[model samples]
Target chain A: MAKDTMIEELLDAWEETYKKGQLTFWVFLALKESNKCMEEIKEFVERASDGTMTCEEQSLYRNLRKFQNLDIVAYDSRKVSKGPDRKYYYLTTTGEELFKRFVERNIMIFTKESIINLLTQ
Target chain B: MRVFTQRLGQFAISALIFTVAFRYALDLSVGMKSFPAALVCSIVYFGLMFFAGWYYGSKDAVENEIHDIGFRFHFITYVLCIALGYASYFIGWNTEPLRSLNIGAMSWGIGLALHFVFFLFAQKNAIRGYVKEEIFQ
Candidate 1:
């Protein structure tokens, strides 16, 4: 529960920090990990953080769509089984640059070791 | 919505406190009386946030927040660069000859252009409604 709250806080806390054109850092990071759809991204985040995701499925999809609008990320719909096509998303060049620049800027404060640990497992 | 807003409020308060402490310490050395305290504060704040994101991964809540804050600062800086460039041009300021060629505006405008190309134009078929296409086409 505490972890869930923390996750929620961290995700929502970023709203205050959205100055202009900026998307949430976590969303970018998640996209960078793989070119997965919303559901896959949600599951990945939960597994990565030991089921600590506090936001629901809709929020994840909403963020993805926003990223699409910003041209940071793009999606292609692949054929899924019965119901509908599954959209797979990947970071565009702009998205990659933004994420890279963001990391470079915070390299000193967040520490490489910590980031490595976080991304690796 | 309520919960999200509450969390955002908390983030704002925490950021305010951190800025105050950081500015106070920086003011001791830079002497805000002479130098532009506002400029110094903005620089230091961005420097710290950027440094944090670079050093620490956005694994936890605090680290993640720091990363996003850096993004906000960058986004704002680029916007301000373009805005102030236009402002200076219109104000008919003196220092430089070609006021039209604002370096900040030109360079940052390229950044914005790239944002449009890769993010907007990359996926040509994106705008179509998925459900609509899925059913019709």
Candidate 2:
């Protein structure tokens, strides 16, 4: 499919996951800044929430780290800084593909029944 | 309710222990001779706990309480102990020994040892009743 179409589908999937408590808004934001480094990530996080995150938000970030399809990295940005000044990131091909698929599927799976079932089970 | 209060009390005790260790290891007194930096550090430590308690106390009734109390105790005690060690080094920068190896060793050793003990205890107790209920029901 077209890249735009794929991106939309991934976004739709993300929205569904978010409603189902599988994904969080902060994860989406981090995914948006997949190309940025550690410092950039920090800046993005700070800016996104007006300089602070609650414990839940922090926990969500931790959960995002466990997603098998995502490949966040921390490497030295040769374009920006030299040795000893590395940057962190989270933009791998697998992450990109997963996100695309998520958006394209447009699965309407985040219903109250599904959520209750998940919580009870 | 009892568990919540007990955990809070434990956190308070740990904080007090850390504060005492910090003051002694760093020669910080509360009188007129006390350094402004020491006062600021103490305030910041308590302030952090206050905010942490308020925030976590209101989140998920069970999860937040456990996390908040656990995090405050561990984080404050560890940070204060390390800060005291580092501050001792900076203060004694021009002295004969140049640093208080004894203070650093004691602070780090006690802080880390106690942290591990408390961590294990908390983990063991985290889901005791809840897990049983969930499993049986």
Index of the highest-lDDT prediction: 1
Fnat of model 2, as a fraction: 0.00
Give the range where candidate 2 chain A is weakest over 10 consecutive residues by summed lDDT.
Answer: A66-75
Writing each residue's lDDT as its tens digit, candidate 2 over A5-121 gives: 999999888766554542334444565665555445556666776654322445543444333212432233445455665444554665566556765564435546977699789
Q: Report the C-alpha lDDT of model 2 over B6-108, residue by residue, as the tens digit.
A: 4455555656665555555335443345567566756766676566555444543344333223544455456655555466556653221324656665666
RMSD after Cα superposition, model 1: 19.7
Clashes of each: 18, 8
**Pairs of colliding residues, candidate 2:** A9-A102, A9-A103, A9-A104, A10-A102, A10-A103, A10-A104, A11-A103, A38-A88
Residue-level lDDT of model 1, residues A49-89, one tens digit each, is: 56544346765666566557557789999997798998999
Q: Point to the candidate with the largest TM-score.
A: 1
Per-residue alpha-carbon lDDT of model 1 for B1-137, expressed as tens digits? 01122333444444545544554544453543445665666687777645543433333223122213233333444554455445444555422234455765677778766664654343344332122122111
Q: Which interface RMSD does candidate 1 score? A: 15.4
DockQ of 2: 0.02
